[model samples]
Target: MSYQENYIKQLHTLLRLVTDSVEGYKSAAEHVDSTEYKDLFNNISRQRESIAAEFRERISGYGGNAEVESPDLMASLHRSWMGIKTAMTKKDDQAVMESCRNGDQALLDAFDDILQGDLLNNADLKTFIMDQRLKVNEVFLDLDDRYFKLFKKDPSI
Candidate 1:
Protein backbone atom coordinates (compact mmCIF):
# COMPACT_ATOMS: atom_id res chain seq x y z
CA MET A 1 0.00 0.00 0.00
CA SER A 2 1.01 3.59 -0.56
CA TYR A 3 2.06 5.76 2.36
CA GLN A 4 -1.22 7.63 2.36
CA GLU A 5 -3.17 4.38 2.26
CA ASN A 6 -1.20 2.95 5.16
CA TYR A 7 -1.57 6.09 7.25
CA ILE A 8 -5.29 6.26 6.61
CA LYS A 9 -5.63 2.60 7.44
CA GLN A 10 -4.01 3.20 10.81
CA LEU A 11 -6.37 6.07 11.53
CA HIS A 12 -9.31 3.89 10.57
CA THR A 13 -8.18 1.21 12.97
CA LEU A 14 -7.96 3.72 15.79
CA LEU A 15 -11.31 5.17 14.88
CA ARG A 16 -12.96 1.77 14.99
CA LEU A 17 -11.41 0.98 18.35
CA VAL A 18 -12.54 4.25 19.85
CA THR A 19 -16.00 3.76 18.45
CA ASP A 20 -16.14 0.35 20.04
CA SER A 21 -15.01 1.84 23.32
CA VAL A 22 -17.81 4.37 23.17
CA GLU A 23 -20.36 1.63 22.79
CA GLY A 24 -18.75 -0.49 25.44
CA TYR A 25 -18.78 2.33 27.97
CA LYS A 26 -22.35 3.16 27.22
CA SER A 27 -23.29 -0.47 27.63
CA ALA A 28 -21.46 -0.63 30.92
CA ALA A 29 -23.24 2.44 32.16
CA GLU A 30 -26.58 0.88 31.25
CA HIS A 31 -25.82 -2.45 32.84
CA VAL A 32 -24.39 -1.24 36.12
CA ASP A 33 -26.61 -0.30 39.07
CA SER A 34 -24.31 2.19 40.73
CA THR A 35 -25.24 5.77 39.89
CA GLU A 36 -21.63 6.83 40.22
CA TYR A 37 -20.44 4.09 37.93
CA LYS A 38 -23.10 4.97 35.40
CA ASP A 39 -22.04 8.60 35.39
CA LEU A 40 -18.38 7.69 35.06
CA PHE A 41 -18.99 5.35 32.17
CA ASN A 42 -21.18 7.88 30.37
CA ASN A 43 -18.54 10.58 30.73
CA ILE A 44 -15.87 8.25 29.40
CA SER A 45 -18.13 7.36 26.51
CA ARG A 46 -18.35 11.04 25.60
CA GLN A 47 -14.60 11.41 25.78
CA ARG A 48 -14.16 8.43 23.46
CA GLU A 49 -16.72 9.87 21.04
CA SER A 50 -14.68 13.07 20.84
CA ILE A 51 -11.52 11.09 20.15
CA ALA A 52 -13.31 9.13 17.44
CA ALA A 53 -14.32 12.42 15.84
CA GLU A 54 -10.71 13.48 15.69
CA PHE A 55 -9.76 10.23 14.00
CA ARG A 56 -12.53 10.72 11.46
CA GLU A 57 -11.27 14.20 10.69
CA ARG A 58 -7.72 12.97 10.29
CA ILE A 59 -8.84 10.22 7.93
CA SER A 60 -10.86 12.71 5.89
CA GLY A 61 -7.93 15.12 5.67
CA TYR A 62 -5.88 12.29 4.20
CA GLY A 63 -8.44 11.86 1.42
CA GLY A 64 -9.77 8.58 2.81
CA ASN A 65 -13.27 7.57 3.75
CA ALA A 66 -13.75 8.05 7.47
CA GLU A 67 -16.95 6.07 7.85
CA VAL A 68 -16.73 2.76 9.70
CA GLU A 69 -19.25 0.58 7.92
CA SER A 70 -19.56 -1.82 10.80
CA PRO A 71 -18.21 -2.57 14.28
CA ASP A 72 -15.13 -4.77 14.52
CA LEU A 73 -16.03 -8.43 14.95
CA MET A 74 -13.97 -8.94 18.08
CA ALA A 75 -15.40 -5.85 19.72
CA SER A 76 -18.93 -6.94 18.91
CA LEU A 77 -18.25 -10.33 20.41
CA HIS A 78 -16.75 -8.77 23.50
CA ARG A 79 -19.79 -6.58 23.99
CA SER A 80 -22.03 -9.59 23.63
CA TRP A 81 -20.00 -11.47 26.18
CA MET A 82 -20.20 -8.52 28.55
CA GLY A 83 -23.98 -8.49 28.23
CA ILE A 84 -24.21 -12.20 28.90
CA LYS A 85 -21.88 -11.99 31.85
CA THR A 86 -23.84 -9.11 33.33
CA ALA A 87 -27.03 -11.12 33.00
CA MET A 88 -25.46 -14.22 34.50
CA THR A 89 -24.13 -12.23 37.39
CA LYS A 90 -27.53 -10.61 37.84
CA LYS A 91 -26.19 -7.15 36.98
CA ASP A 92 -23.50 -7.35 39.58
CA ASP A 93 -21.55 -4.10 39.84
CA GLN A 94 -18.24 -5.90 40.28
CA ALA A 95 -18.81 -7.99 37.20
CA VAL A 96 -19.69 -4.91 35.18
CA MET A 97 -16.61 -3.12 36.41
CA GLU A 98 -14.40 -6.09 35.59
CA SER A 99 -15.77 -6.24 32.06
CA CYS A 100 -15.19 -2.53 31.58
CA ARG A 101 -11.67 -2.91 32.84
CA ASN A 102 -10.98 -5.63 30.32
CA GLY A 103 -12.45 -3.56 27.50
CA ASP A 104 -10.32 -0.58 28.48
CA GLN A 105 -7.23 -2.78 28.51
CA ALA A 106 -8.03 -3.93 24.98
CA LEU A 107 -8.23 -0.30 23.93
CA LEU A 108 -4.89 0.49 25.55
CA ASP A 109 -3.35 -2.50 23.81
CA ALA A 110 -4.52 -1.19 20.44
CA PHE A 111 -2.94 2.16 21.16
CA ASP A 112 0.31 0.43 22.09
CA ASP A 113 0.25 -1.59 18.91
CA ILE A 114 -0.13 1.47 16.70
CA LEU A 115 2.40 3.54 18.62
CA GLN A 116 5.02 0.80 18.33
CA GLY A 117 4.62 0.61 14.56
CA ASP A 118 6.92 2.56 12.21
CA LEU A 119 4.04 3.44 9.93
CA LEU A 120 3.01 6.20 12.34
CA ASN A 121 5.98 8.36 11.42
CA ASN A 122 4.15 11.64 11.14
CA ALA A 123 5.24 13.75 14.09
CA ASP A 124 1.89 15.48 14.59
CA LEU A 125 -0.13 12.29 14.32
CA LYS A 126 2.26 10.49 16.62
CA THR A 127 1.94 13.21 19.24
CA PHE A 128 -1.83 13.18 18.92
CA ILE A 129 -1.94 9.44 19.37
CA MET A 130 0.35 9.66 22.37
CA ASP A 131 -1.84 12.26 24.02
CA GLN A 132 -4.95 10.21 23.45
CA ARG A 133 -3.23 7.10 24.75
CA LEU A 134 -2.22 8.92 27.91
CA LYS A 135 -5.78 10.02 28.48
CA VAL A 136 -6.98 6.45 28.05
CA ASN A 137 -4.26 5.08 30.31
CA GLU A 138 -5.17 7.55 33.02
CA VAL A 139 -8.78 6.40 32.98
CA PHE A 140 -7.76 2.75 32.85
CA LEU A 141 -5.63 3.18 35.93
CA ASP A 142 -8.45 4.91 37.76
CA LEU A 143 -10.77 2.05 36.90
CA ASP A 144 -8.20 -0.45 38.07
CA ASP A 145 -7.83 1.34 41.39
CA ARG A 146 -11.55 1.48 41.87
CA TYR A 147 -11.93 -2.21 41.07
CA PHE A 148 -9.25 -3.17 43.56
CA LYS A 149 -10.74 -0.98 46.25
CA LEU A 150 -14.11 -2.57 45.73
CA PHE A 151 -12.57 -6.01 45.71
CA LYS A 152 -10.63 -5.30 48.87
CA LYS A 153 -13.65 -3.94 50.70
CA ASP A 154 -15.57 -7.07 49.89
CA PRO A 155 -13.73 -10.16 48.77
CA SER A 156 -17.03 -11.64 47.73
CA ILE A 157 -17.24 -9.05 44.98
Candidate 2:
Protein backbone atom coordinates (compact mmCIF):
# COMPACT_ATOMS: atom_id res chain seq x y z
CA MET A 1 0.00 0.00 0.00
CA SER A 2 1.06 3.57 -0.68
CA TYR A 3 1.83 5.98 2.12
CA GLN A 4 -1.46 7.70 1.39
CA GLU A 5 -3.26 4.41 1.70
CA ASN A 6 -1.46 3.45 4.87
CA TYR A 7 -2.00 6.85 6.43
CA ILE A 8 -5.66 6.81 5.52
CA LYS A 9 -6.06 3.37 7.04
CA GLN A 10 -4.48 4.50 10.29
CA LEU A 11 -6.52 7.69 10.41
CA HIS A 12 -9.64 5.69 9.67
CA THR A 13 -8.81 3.31 12.45
CA LEU A 14 -8.25 6.19 14.88
CA LEU A 15 -11.47 7.99 13.95
CA ARG A 16 -13.48 4.82 14.32
CA LEU A 17 -11.92 4.35 17.70
CA VAL A 18 -13.02 7.88 18.57
CA THR A 19 -16.55 7.02 17.52
CA ASP A 20 -16.55 3.93 19.68
CA SER A 21 -15.13 5.74 22.69
CA VAL A 22 -17.70 8.50 22.34
CA GLU A 23 -20.48 5.95 22.32
CA GLY A 24 -19.04 4.34 25.39
CA TYR A 25 -18.88 7.71 27.11
CA LYS A 26 -22.49 8.37 26.16
CA SER A 27 -23.52 5.00 27.58
CA ALA A 28 -21.51 5.52 30.74
CA ALA A 29 -23.08 8.94 31.20
CA GLU A 30 -26.51 7.38 31.01
CA HIS A 31 -25.54 5.06 33.83
CA VAL A 32 -23.57 7.69 35.74
CA ASP A 33 -26.49 9.65 37.21
CA SER A 34 -24.14 12.58 37.76
CA THR A 35 -24.67 15.97 36.15
CA GLU A 36 -20.94 16.59 35.85
CA TYR A 37 -20.36 13.24 34.23
CA LYS A 38 -23.23 13.82 31.83
CA ASP A 39 -21.79 17.17 30.81
CA LEU A 40 -18.41 15.61 30.05
CA PHE A 41 -20.06 12.83 28.04
CA ASN A 42 -22.05 15.29 25.96
CA ASN A 43 -18.97 17.41 25.32
CA ILE A 44 -17.00 14.38 24.22
CA SER A 45 -19.79 13.36 21.87
CA ARG A 46 -19.73 16.78 20.20
CA GLN A 47 -15.96 16.79 19.94
CA ARG A 48 -15.95 13.29 18.50
CA GLU A 49 -18.45 14.31 15.86
CA SER A 50 -16.29 17.23 14.78
CA ILE A 51 -13.11 15.15 14.68
CA ALA A 52 -14.82 12.38 12.73
CA ALA A 53 -16.11 14.86 10.19
CA GLU A 54 -12.64 16.32 9.72
CA PHE A 55 -11.19 12.84 9.19
CA ARG A 56 -13.96 11.99 6.74
CA GLU A 57 -13.12 15.07 4.71
CA ARG A 58 -9.44 14.16 4.67
CA ILE A 59 -10.09 10.55 3.59
CA SER A 60 -12.40 11.66 0.82
CA GLY A 61 -9.57 13.71 -0.65
CA TYR A 62 -7.94 10.42 -1.62
CA GLY A 63 -11.04 9.36 -3.58
CA GLY A 64 -11.86 6.81 -0.89
CA ASN A 65 -14.98 6.22 1.09
CA ALA A 66 -15.19 8.77 3.86
CA GLU A 67 -16.78 6.36 6.29
CA VAL A 68 -16.43 2.60 6.21
CA GLU A 69 -17.27 0.21 9.00
CA SER A 70 -16.14 -3.34 9.36
CA PRO A 71 -18.02 -5.56 11.74
CA ASP A 72 -14.97 -7.35 13.08
CA LEU A 73 -12.90 -4.25 13.70
CA MET A 74 -15.71 -2.21 15.14
CA ALA A 75 -16.79 -5.01 17.43
CA SER A 76 -13.24 -5.57 18.57
CA LEU A 77 -12.68 -1.91 19.37
CA HIS A 78 -15.92 -1.66 21.29
CA ARG A 79 -15.14 -4.78 23.27
CA SER A 80 -11.62 -3.60 24.01
CA TRP A 81 -12.80 -0.25 25.30
CA MET A 82 -15.46 -1.90 27.39
CA GLY A 83 -12.80 -3.84 29.21
CA ILE A 84 -10.64 -0.74 29.49
CA LYS A 85 -13.41 1.33 30.99
CA THR A 86 -14.28 -1.41 33.43
CA ALA A 87 -10.70 -1.73 34.60
CA MET A 88 -10.33 2.03 34.91
CA THR A 89 -13.53 2.20 36.95
CA LYS A 90 -12.21 -0.47 39.24
CA LYS A 91 -9.30 1.87 39.99
CA ASP A 92 -10.96 5.26 40.59
CA ASP A 93 -12.60 8.26 38.92
CA GLN A 94 -9.18 9.82 38.46
CA ALA A 95 -8.00 6.74 36.61
CA VAL A 96 -10.97 6.86 34.27
CA MET A 97 -10.26 10.53 33.56
CA GLU A 98 -6.61 9.76 32.90
CA SER A 99 -7.58 7.01 30.48
CA CYS A 100 -9.70 9.42 28.50
CA ARG A 101 -6.85 11.90 28.44
CA ASN A 102 -4.44 9.25 27.27
CA GLY A 103 -6.71 8.18 24.45
CA ASP A 104 -7.08 11.73 23.18
CA GLN A 105 -3.35 12.28 23.47
CA ALA A 106 -2.67 9.24 21.33
CA LEU A 107 -4.98 10.44 18.57
CA LEU A 108 -3.55 13.92 18.68
CA ASP A 109 -0.02 12.56 18.37
CA ALA A 110 -1.00 10.42 15.38
CA PHE A 111 -2.36 13.40 13.53
CA ASP A 112 0.67 15.48 14.37
CA ASP A 113 2.87 12.78 12.88
CA ILE A 114 0.81 12.78 9.69
CA LEU A 115 1.04 16.53 9.44
CA GLN A 116 4.80 16.49 9.85
CA GLY A 117 5.37 13.73 7.31
CA ASP A 118 6.11 14.34 3.60
CA LEU A 119 2.57 13.20 2.81
CA LEU A 120 1.46 16.60 4.04
CA ASN A 121 3.65 18.35 1.46
CA ASN A 122 0.77 18.20 -0.99
CA ALA A 123 -1.64 21.07 -1.57
CA ASP A 124 -4.51 19.13 -0.05
CA LEU A 125 -2.78 18.71 3.28
CA LYS A 126 -1.37 22.21 3.14
CA THR A 127 -4.83 23.68 2.76
CA PHE A 128 -6.41 21.49 5.42
CA ILE A 129 -3.57 21.80 7.86
CA MET A 130 -3.87 25.56 7.96
CA ASP A 131 -7.40 25.06 9.29
CA GLN A 132 -8.19 21.59 10.65
CA ARG A 133 -4.87 20.74 12.25
CA LEU A 134 -4.94 23.72 14.58
CA LYS A 135 -8.51 22.94 15.56
CA VAL A 136 -7.63 19.32 16.34
CA ASN A 137 -4.71 20.40 18.50
CA GLU A 138 -6.99 22.77 20.38
CA VAL A 139 -9.46 19.98 20.99
CA PHE A 140 -6.67 17.80 22.29
CA LEU A 141 -5.62 20.48 24.72
CA ASP A 142 -9.18 20.88 25.95
CA LEU A 143 -9.61 17.15 26.47
CA ASP A 144 -6.35 17.07 28.43
CA ASP A 145 -7.60 19.84 30.68
CA ARG A 146 -10.95 18.19 31.22
CA TYR A 147 -9.33 15.02 32.52
CA PHE A 148 -6.36 16.62 34.21
CA LYS A 149 -8.64 18.62 36.47
CA LEU A 150 -10.12 15.48 37.94
CA PHE A 151 -6.69 14.05 38.59
CA LYS A 152 -5.65 17.28 40.26
CA LYS A 153 -8.36 16.94 42.88
CA ASP A 154 -6.84 13.79 44.26
CA PRO A 155 -3.64 12.38 42.78
CA SER A 156 -4.36 9.04 44.43
CA ILE A 157 -8.12 9.12 44.47
Candidate 3:
Protein backbone atom coordinates (compact mmCIF):
# COMPACT_ATOMS: atom_id res chain seq x y z
CA MET A 1 0.00 0.00 0.00
CA SER A 2 0.89 3.67 -0.22
CA TYR A 3 2.72 5.47 2.58
CA GLN A 4 -0.33 7.45 3.68
CA GLU A 5 -2.47 4.33 3.77
CA ASN A 6 0.11 2.61 5.92
CA TYR A 7 0.21 5.50 8.35
CA ILE A 8 -3.56 5.65 8.65
CA LYS A 9 -3.71 1.92 9.20
CA GLN A 10 -1.23 2.10 12.05
CA LEU A 11 -3.02 5.03 13.65
CA HIS A 12 -6.33 3.19 13.46
CA THR A 13 -4.81 0.16 15.09
CA LEU A 14 -3.45 2.29 17.94
CA LEU A 15 -6.77 4.03 18.29
CA ARG A 16 -8.56 0.72 18.61
CA LEU A 17 -6.10 -0.42 21.24
CA VAL A 18 -6.58 2.77 23.23
CA THR A 19 -10.35 2.43 23.03
CA ASP A 20 -10.15 -1.18 24.19
CA SER A 21 -7.83 -0.22 27.03
CA VAL A 22 -10.39 2.22 28.36
CA GLU A 23 -12.98 -0.53 28.49
CA GLY A 24 -10.55 -3.00 29.96
CA TYR A 25 -9.62 -0.61 32.76
CA LYS A 26 -13.28 0.04 33.46
CA SER A 27 -13.94 -3.64 33.70
CA ALA A 28 -11.02 -4.11 36.03
CA ALA A 29 -12.26 -1.29 38.23
CA GLU A 30 -15.65 -2.88 38.47
CA HIS A 31 -14.29 -6.29 39.31
CA VAL A 32 -11.54 -5.33 41.76
CA ASP A 33 -12.72 -4.88 45.34
CA SER A 34 -9.89 -2.57 46.38
CA THR A 35 -10.82 1.08 46.24
CA GLU A 36 -7.25 2.03 45.42
CA TYR A 37 -7.14 -0.29 42.45
CA LYS A 38 -10.59 0.75 41.33
CA ASP A 39 -9.75 4.45 41.37
CA LEU A 40 -6.48 3.88 39.62
CA PHE A 41 -8.17 1.87 36.88
CA ASN A 42 -10.82 4.53 36.41
CA ASN A 43 -8.28 7.29 36.08
CA ILE A 44 -6.22 5.28 33.63
CA SER A 45 -9.35 4.64 31.66
CA ARG A 46 -9.94 8.38 31.36
CA GLN A 47 -6.38 8.98 30.33
CA ARG A 48 -6.69 6.35 27.65
CA GLU A 49 -9.82 8.00 26.37
CA SER A 50 -7.97 11.28 26.10
CA ILE A 51 -5.19 9.51 24.24
CA ALA A 52 -7.67 7.98 21.84
CA ALA A 53 -9.19 11.39 21.24
CA GLU A 54 -5.79 12.74 20.38
CA PHE A 55 -5.28 9.88 17.96
CA ARG A 56 -8.62 10.55 16.33
CA GLU A 57 -7.72 14.20 15.92
CA ARG A 58 -4.42 13.29 14.38
CA ILE A 59 -6.05 10.90 11.95
CA SER A 60 -8.51 13.61 10.93
CA GLY A 61 -5.72 16.08 10.37
CA TYR A 62 -4.38 13.72 7.76
CA GLY A 63 -7.73 13.87 5.94
CA GLY A 64 -8.33 10.29 6.86
CA ASN A 65 -11.54 8.94 8.26
CA ALA A 66 -11.42 8.08 11.97
CA GLU A 67 -13.41 4.93 12.46
CA VAL A 68 -14.06 3.43 15.86
CA GLU A 69 -13.87 -0.32 15.64
CA SER A 70 -14.58 -2.91 18.28
CA PRO A 71 -11.68 -4.45 20.10
CA ASP A 72 -10.10 -7.34 18.22
CA LEU A 73 -11.17 -10.90 18.95
CA MET A 74 -8.05 -11.65 20.92
CA ALA A 75 -8.63 -8.76 23.24
CA SER A 76 -12.25 -9.70 23.71
CA LEU A 77 -11.27 -13.28 24.50
CA HIS A 78 -8.66 -12.06 26.97
CA ARG A 79 -11.26 -10.06 28.85
CA SER A 80 -13.62 -13.01 28.98
CA TRP A 81 -10.82 -15.22 30.22
CA MET A 82 -9.95 -12.73 32.93
CA GLY A 83 -13.57 -12.53 34.06
CA ILE A 84 -13.84 -16.27 34.30
CA LYS A 85 -10.46 -16.66 35.99
CA THR A 86 -11.28 -14.01 38.58
CA ALA A 87 -14.67 -15.53 39.27
CA MET A 88 -13.33 -19.05 39.65
CA THR A 89 -10.21 -18.20 41.65
CA LYS A 90 -11.57 -15.21 43.60
CA LYS A 91 -8.19 -13.61 42.93
CA ASP A 92 -9.54 -10.36 41.61
CA ASP A 93 -6.47 -8.25 42.20
CA GLN A 94 -4.07 -10.76 40.74
CA ALA A 95 -6.27 -11.48 37.77
CA VAL A 96 -6.83 -7.82 37.03
CA MET A 97 -3.13 -7.08 37.33
CA GLU A 98 -2.30 -9.96 35.05
CA SER A 99 -4.73 -8.69 32.47
CA CYS A 100 -3.33 -5.19 32.77
CA ARG A 101 0.17 -6.50 32.24
CA ASN A 102 -0.90 -8.38 29.17
CA GLY A 103 -2.64 -5.37 27.74
CA ASP A 104 0.32 -3.16 28.41
CA GLN A 105 2.60 -5.64 26.74
CA ALA A 106 0.42 -5.67 23.66
CA LEU A 107 0.51 -1.88 23.51
CA LEU A 108 4.25 -1.83 24.01
CA ASP A 109 4.72 -4.28 21.20
CA ALA A 110 2.56 -2.23 18.89
CA PHE A 111 4.41 0.94 19.77
CA ASP A 112 7.71 -0.77 19.19
CA ASP A 113 6.62 -1.99 15.78
CA ILE A 114 5.33 1.44 14.81
CA LEU A 115 8.47 3.17 15.94
CA GLN A 116 10.63 0.73 14.02
CA GLY A 117 8.63 0.98 10.84
CA ASP A 118 9.45 3.36 8.01
CA LEU A 119 5.92 4.76 8.21
CA LEU A 120 6.77 7.14 11.07
CA ASN A 121 8.83 9.71 9.14
CA ASN A 122 6.11 12.19 9.95
CA ALA A 123 7.58 14.20 12.80
CA ASP A 124 4.35 14.78 14.71
CA LEU A 125 3.31 11.15 14.57
CA LYS A 126 6.79 9.96 15.46
CA THR A 127 6.96 12.27 18.45
CA PHE A 128 3.57 11.20 19.71
CA ILE A 129 4.37 7.53 19.25
CA MET A 130 7.67 7.88 21.08
CA ASP A 131 6.02 9.69 23.98
CA GLN A 132 3.40 6.97 24.18
CA ARG A 133 6.04 4.26 24.04
CA LEU A 134 7.86 5.81 27.01
CA LYS A 135 4.66 6.01 29.03
CA VAL A 136 3.75 2.42 28.20
CA ASN A 137 7.21 1.18 29.11
CA GLU A 138 6.96 2.88 32.49
CA VAL A 139 3.61 1.21 33.09
CA PHE A 140 5.02 -2.18 32.18
CA LEU A 141 7.84 -1.67 34.66
CA ASP A 142 5.42 -0.73 37.45
CA LEU A 143 3.21 -3.70 36.70
CA ASP A 144 6.17 -6.00 36.66
CA ASP A 145 7.24 -4.81 40.10
CA ARG A 146 3.73 -5.04 41.46
CA TYR A 147 3.26 -8.54 40.11
CA PHE A 148 6.56 -9.77 41.49
CA LYS A 149 5.85 -8.27 44.90
CA LEU A 150 2.38 -9.79 45.05
CA PHE A 151 3.13 -13.33 43.90
CA LYS A 152 6.86 -13.85 44.26
CA LYS A 153 6.72 -16.12 47.29
CA ASP A 154 4.16 -18.80 47.75
CA PRO A 155 2.51 -18.56 51.15
CA SER A 156 1.95 -22.32 51.15
CA ILE A 157 5.66 -22.91 50.64
Models, CA RMSD each: 1.1, 3.9, 2.0
Q: Considering summed lDDT, which 10 consecutive residues are worst modelled in model 1?
A: 116-125
lDDT of 1 at 37: 97
For model 1, what is the C-alpha lDDT against the true structure? 0.89
Estimate, for each residue in 1-157, the C-alpha lDDT of model 3 and write its tens digit: 7777888888888888778888888988888888988887788888888888888988887778887866766667767877887788685687788888898888888878887886557887899878766876876797788777677654541
Superior by TM-score: candidate 2 or candidate 3: 3
lDDT of 2 by residue, 1-157 (tens): 8877865775676567656656655654554445776687678767767767877887887766877575236434544675577565763445445555565565566556666766564666556644555655665587678767766776874
Name the lDDT value of residue 154 in candidate 2.
69
Best by TM-score: 1
TM-score to native of every candidate shown? 0.95, 0.67, 0.88
lDDT: which candidate is best?
Answer: 1
- What TM-score does candidate 3 get on C-alpha atoms? 0.88
lDDT of 1 by residue, 56-128 (tens): 9989999999999788787888899999999999888889899988988988898899888865678888898
Q: What is the lDDT of residue 102 in candidate 2?
A: 60
Q: After superposition, how far is residue 86 of candidate 1 from its true place, in Å?
A: 0.4
Residue 98 CA displacement from its true place in model 1, Å: 0.7
Model 2 — TM-score against the truth?
0.67
